[model samples]
Target chain A: MRIVEAGKLALESIWANRLRSFLTLLGVIIGIAAIVATAAVIHGLNRYVAEKLSNLGKGVFVVQRFGIITNRQEFLDAARRNKRLLPADARAIAERVPGAEIVGWEVHATADLERGEHVIRDTDIGGVTPAILEIEPYEVAEGRLLLQHEEDHAAAVAFLGHEVAQRLFPNVDPIGKELRIGGARLTVVGTAAQKGSFLGFSQDNYVKIPFSLHQKLYGTLGSVNISVKAREPARLEETIDEVRAVVRARHHLRPGAPDDFGILTAEGINDLWRNLTQTIFRVALFVVGISLVVGGIVIMNIMLVAVVERTREIGVRKAVGASQRDIVQQFLVEAVLLSCLGGAIGIAIAYAAATLLAANTPLPAEFPPWAPPVAFAVCTAIGVFFGIHPARRAAHLDPIEALRSE
Target chain B: MHAAPAPDEVIRTRGLVRSFAMGSATVHALRGVDLVIRRGEYVAIMGPSGSGKSTLMNLIGCLDTPTAGEYWLEGQPIASLGEAELARIRNREIGFVFQTFNLLPRASALRNVELPLVYAQMPPAERRRRATEALQKVGLGDRLDHRPNELSGGQRQRVSIARALVTNPALLLADEPTGNLDSKTSHEIMLLFEALHREGHTIVVVTHERDIAEHAERVVTIRDGAIASDERQPRPVRP
Candidate 1:
């Protein structure tokens, strides 16, 4: 028989017994759904980390006492062994590194802020030199950013983040408002524009101040985080090496001694992020692989049952001149059609679920254009792999013996 | 030893023997049965239970092979052909009608009638056209869309007849064609067979009922795997 006619026969049989077909395909549906949902979540998270957390921008890097550490014990050990970066390190790097375009020192701590009767506790207070704005640009929603003169004179001027301003001066113009932070009175110069959250952490609940004023108020409360920008992106590696040599010279370390400071660039952070994403993807693949195997077995079991139940039909078809190849082709087509149908349903469900999650939850989901096609190919392979045995059984039946079966 | 059959012979069997292994014993079902059937003949094979008439029918239908025999259909040696070749012969040269109608229950009457044509790999429009014509010939043109369950016993049988005729085979083989029907339905089916035979189709009916066997132009009665009598009636009972 022609493939098209066999396909029609398969469809008729599936439609004839809808509930049985659905029950038989349940395992496949669930397996494919799991795969699709995992792919969407991983795709979205990769985009999120690349955009928000990598901190890798053109010609940018950080010099801190401790690098980005994930393990708690390792972080504590690094903090104890690494010397605090001194204030003069930033100036020394700017003077010595020819590739350095901008050098800035940054520090941050959680502090209580009070403005009139409104008070927000545990608000992030960031101390940064004016040059830090050039290294990590922040959009100004109102007024202007801190000026170079303000940082040189240690002026008590501050920039409120979007959320901080919303909380401190709900209905008033926040640019000229004065707020008390850590018992130091400071005037709000501008409000940074809203930058949404990343991985559930709010990015807008903070304020920026000149590092000179921060030193006077908090008396060098913590190690400085030095932000450096290169003159050109292509020269970032050389700039990092030049800055490392200057810091090593300033610290008076021996030629072979390891430097006590950490250098963090966008490349390092991206490597770390990629490793994390790869681990997640591997685990997801392993889990979905198990489910796929289980699903294939289920389909095989059900196909065997179908073959037995239709023995008489097979006999009748053989009597009507169906060759063994024709019988095998018909059954295989039925199996493949069943799996592909289940895969299509699974894809539709996963897409709907991803959209719902994107709309209502903090977790992000993104659908890749190639996911459905690849998933369908895998499903068809599974069908062929699991279906061959049952189809062969139907093909090998003796016509007279099969017709005698009740 | 019999001479080889002429070109006009549709079925020729010589010294046909079939046996079965029943535990430690070999039961010989057919022993040296010789038979010849020509084209455009209506023949009935009748026997009591366990007389090997069913075995002969199966061998003649190419559903099973004989142990020691030379059988020829349409001048081709069938006993030596392979499984696929036999299947093709069945597709092109034989039409089968069963007492239970044997239509695919879920398929429409039109689809049921199109089975052999589908095996022949005919295109959709042509297969449908031929199936429609066959159903119309059986006076079931309006019931093309109805499923087997939706048709009466007589109509269902007619659909099976239509399926049998759809391929325009060299032989129309019926096994107890009226076994499941009432007397009136049986007579109606017998009349239909009479009409088909008059149309110059080669037909064979296998039954144990003398009344049903009487409808054919010739009757062959078997006893203990051997033909007891072979008679040619001057006129068919149904005619």
Candidate 2:
């Protein structure tokens, strides 16, 4: 028989047993939905991380006492082995590293801020050099950034993050407003432009002050983080090596010994992100694979039952001159049609779920354009893989025996 | 043993034998039966249960192959043909009507009639037209859209007959065509067969009922896997 006719016959049979067909499709539906939804979440996260990392400046790199510690053991080891990065290290890198176009350093602590009766608790406060603005550029909404002489003379002036400024000075202009940080009053010199939240955490919720004042208030025991900008983006690796050499020489490390510090670049962060997401993607793939196999087995089992139930019908078809190939084609077509229908339903459900997740939750989801076609192809492969045996069994039945069956 | 069938012959069988292995023992369904039926002949094969008449019918319909024999349909050697070739022969040269009107329960009468043509790979429009013509010939032209469950036993049988005739085969083979019908419906079906035979179609009816066998021009009776009598009646019984 022609394939079209066989398809029509399959559709008729499936339609005749609607509830059974739907039950049979459930496993495949769930399998494909899991795959599509997981892929959408991963795709969205990758884009989000890439965009966030790009905000770290084109060729900027950071040197710190502990960089990207993944586990408690690693954090403990780094804490014991690494030395606190001092302001001297930043000055040495600025003087010695020829490829470093700009070098800046910063120190941070959590502090409570108060203006008369209004108070904001546990807000991040940073002490940064004047040159840090050139390395990591922040847009100013009002007033101006600190001058180079402000750091030299330890001026009691602070730059407020957009959220901090809005909260502390709700009705008045934040510029030149005085705010108390741990009993040390500092006037706000400028307010940074609003930077939106990332992964539901507010980006504009910190205060920046001159490095000399922070040293006096928070003390010099804590380690400082050093930021370096390369003269040319293409030569960033060479500039990083130069900075590494300056820091290692200053620490007096031997040739074979590991450096007592960590250097982080944009590419390093991207690689770490990709490594994490790839692991997640692989686990999702494994789970989806199992579900699909289970789904396929269910389909095969049902098709075998259908073959037995319709033995007499098969005999009638064979008696009407349907060849073994024709019988096989008919059953195989039915199996594929059933699986693809499941895949289509799965794609629709995944799309709806992805849209809902993106709309209502902090977790982002982006439905990939190629998901539907690829899902259908996988489902077709599964159908054929599971369908062949039952179709062959139907084809090989003795016509006389089949006809004799009730 | 390799002789060709005559141009006017519809079926020829020689020393046809069929056996089955029922557990450890073998049962011989047909043993050394020879038969011939020419074109335009209305023949009846009659036998009691376990008399091998059904075996002969199955072999003649190309649904089963004999253990040892030479059988031909429309001058083609079919006993040695493979399953696919036998299926093709069944499609092009033989039409079958079962004891139970075996129409697809879900399909309309028209689609049931179009089944053979579908396997024949005929295009849709042509298949539809020819199937309609066949149903009209069976006097079911107005009942084309009715499913088998919606039709009476007689109408269902007529639909089966239309399906059988749609391919315009060399032989119309019916196995107990009226076994499930009332006497009136049986009489009508037998009359329809008579009309078809009058139009020069080769036909075979397998039944144990003497009255049903009497409708044919000739009757062959089987006893214990062999033909006991083969007689040509001067005049076949009418309605």
Q: Best candidate per lDDT, number?
A: 2
Error of 2 at A246 (Å): 2.8
- For each candidate, C-alpha RMSD in Å? 2.7, 2.1
Task: Give the Å shift of residue A214 in candidate 1.
Answer: 2.0
lDDT of 1 by residue, B106-165 (tens): 889999899989999999899999999999999999999999999999999999999999
Please give each candidate's TM-score: 0.92, 0.95
Which model scores highest in TM-score? 2
Off by over 4 Å in 1: A53-56, A241-263, B1-5, B226-229, B237-239
Clash pairs for candidate 1:
none
DockQ, cand. 2: 0.79
Find the 10 residues in a row with the least total lDDT in model 2 chain B: B230-239
lDDT by residue (A1-406, candidate 2, tens digit) is: 8889989999999899889998998999999999999989888888888888898999999999988889999989889989999999999999998888899999999999999888999999899998787788888999998778889988999999999999999999988889999989999999999988777889999999999999999999879999999989999999999899999999999998988899998889988998999999899999999999999999999999999999999999999999999999999999999899899999999999999998988777889898999999999998899999999999999988898899
Q: Give the per-residue lDDT of model 2 (tens digit) for B1-239.
A: 45578889899999999999999999999998989999999999999999999999999999999999899898899888998898899899889999998888989999999999999999999999999999999999999999999999999999999999999999999999999999999999999999999999999999999999999999999999999999999786453
Deviation of model 2 at B34, angstroms: 1.3
Model 1 chain B — which ten-residue stretch has the worst lDDT?
B230-239
